[model samples]
Target: MIRKLLLILFGMGCVALQGQLAYEGVVLDADTGTPIPFVNIGIVDRGVGTISNENGEFLLEFRPREVQQGDIVRISSLGYIPRKIPVSLLNDDVLKLIIRLQPNPVSLEEVVLTDKEYVEVEDEVGYRDLLGKGIGYWKDSVALGGELASKIRVRKGLRRLNTLFFNVLHNPSDSVRLRVNIYEPADKWGAPGKNLNESGRSILHVLRSHEILTVIDLKPYNIWVRDDFIVSLELLGVFGTENISLSLPAGNLPGVPSHRRYTSQGSWERIDDSAVGFWLQSTFYTDKPRKANKPRQLRKREKKEREISGTVFEIISSGRSEMRSRRRGATISNYTSNKSVKTDEWGRFRIKAVKGDILGVSYPGMYQVLTKVEEISFYNFQLYPVKN
Candidate 1:
């Protein structure tokens, strides 16, 4: 049964500030005509996200001027192709607002092996440390409807991912729904981009009781990856009280910098106020042993010698050089590209620069200094405390 989403325009009724409207809709399977549960409904990178209820119904509130002609609301779900709707189509007073999604099943990859025997390796790696405190969302701060992602560096080649492990820093809610998503490193700034989990099945987990550590099996998906990837724990919904957080210790092995963003499409700010730690561990099987990360001190020396050819960019896939190159580093946010980098204490940083790029040097309390890229390859910045 094919159905068009029925939307009725309220046209700034009652307490109208430009145009007041309420949006309520239901998601259904295009072929089955049955309600789909837990469908992700949100504006792309706009920091707006919500999930359909068990009844396959959802309601999201939007402020005036929030919707534009080209803006779209994305509906993403497991075992279905993502759907997008234009903002101009939204309205109110519709009884049967039906949105249908088509199924998208991922084709499993066939494995081929040669007779040559090599090595089989199993490894569990991530920041798996339990300390006194962690990032407490909803409780410590407001529940931002987005994901908190941390970069997880892995070796190059194929690895059969086994389980994803995360430490629950705190969970005051009786129950909550969480989604695990894996992402490929973006080509532009190396931020989390392009969903890598091609299984077409949502890795959903429900928490009944609070446990210090939670492990999710990845073997069922048969996921394999090379180079570096990102793991994010997304908050789907909160049952009972609004208290849920994926926690890690205060800091990593040290010198590792952390960045925070509210929405998938929101702007990223450096977590420079304090060294907040974020670590996600995963176990995987491979045919070769993992390469040991070079010591930071050694990598630093090699960097000063410019042996890495500046590596072009400081963010390396191995992440061994991430902290080695970012300790006491100044954060350089590329306003033009929305990418950020940090200059080491020696006042050195690297970014893919082009002409007319507006770069801002910022700190938590100080005013930001914006510098336009000309023919210069170096810049110096000093921040003073904001006036009271």
Candidate 2:
């Protein structure tokens, strides 16, 4: 009986080893045959994923029980067509592949422009020590085509943009390349809308530490923004494989109100918890009246007007008794104006908001609720606990 048990144990071990799957591959550009780094590879709907290394090489491992026979593996990269393959087709326990990705075709739109000299319309300057975390593509999974965007409110129509300048704290030891993209705001939520720039290949070079002020010239590109727009910085590539651990420094500025926002999952969101703001400045030429061209003065006056006319609204939360303790820090944010406030210990909060503004209520373990501000004040919110 002991000899038979040992034989069965050995047989099970061999079967387990045979069930293990190891996949190795290199991602390359189909046209140039050059390796594409930081490609995102994953099993569809399985939540198992990995990124290719700097050399475009990747290894994916699956335990006997983790993978299904028909599970599909997906490979995707920015500006490249994504590819998918089935697990059953990979016959060998240890399989190798050289996957090629085709570059996505990009059409350049014609930019209409009237000749104009760019003037500094708006500026936000207050750079403290680097705030290690602001917002950007910092992880390998979202590194390719990863973007961070800042919302800039423009009161008047603009003829052309001159330049955008911002400071970056570079990792002096490593070299990195970044792309700058500009877009029109999609809606009141501050998401990126249409690509305003003709070419998305604008690159910035990071050389030294001590707050390198990178400038992006927009004159040659003929980009124009009428009202408000978003400026985004995209992480393109890190120079060497050894420098994979290094990330682009987050732009830091002294705390300013309602001007900072970022995106990591393709949707823009505000940065509220901290006082530091992302360092971003824009210079452009506006064709509107001189009064409309004075953004800083206009903003100040508008803020004062809002304060005078703004209505104070109270929010109340009613939910399950189990979730009452978790609703104290619920946040009330105005999506249109970017103003935010928090609920108090009693789940009550007051905010000065104007009509036509969209308000969102969010809590840690509750479903977020959005309501449009009307002409009245004193609003009550019903908070519901999130279903697991």
Whose lDDT is greatest here?
1
**Model 1 ranges off by over 4 Å:** 1-20, 92-96, 108-113, 130-145, 243-247, 250-388
Cα lDDT tens digits, model 2, 67-107, are 68888777776567677777665554324567788887876
TM-score of 2: 0.43
Question: What local lDDT does model 1 show for residue 345?
Answer: 61
lDDT of 1 at 259: 44
Reference-based lDDT, each prediction? 0.57, 0.54
Quote the lDDT for 107 in model 1: 74
- Name the lDDT of candidate 2: 0.54
lDDT of 2 at 386: 67
lDDT value, candidate 1, whole model: 0.57
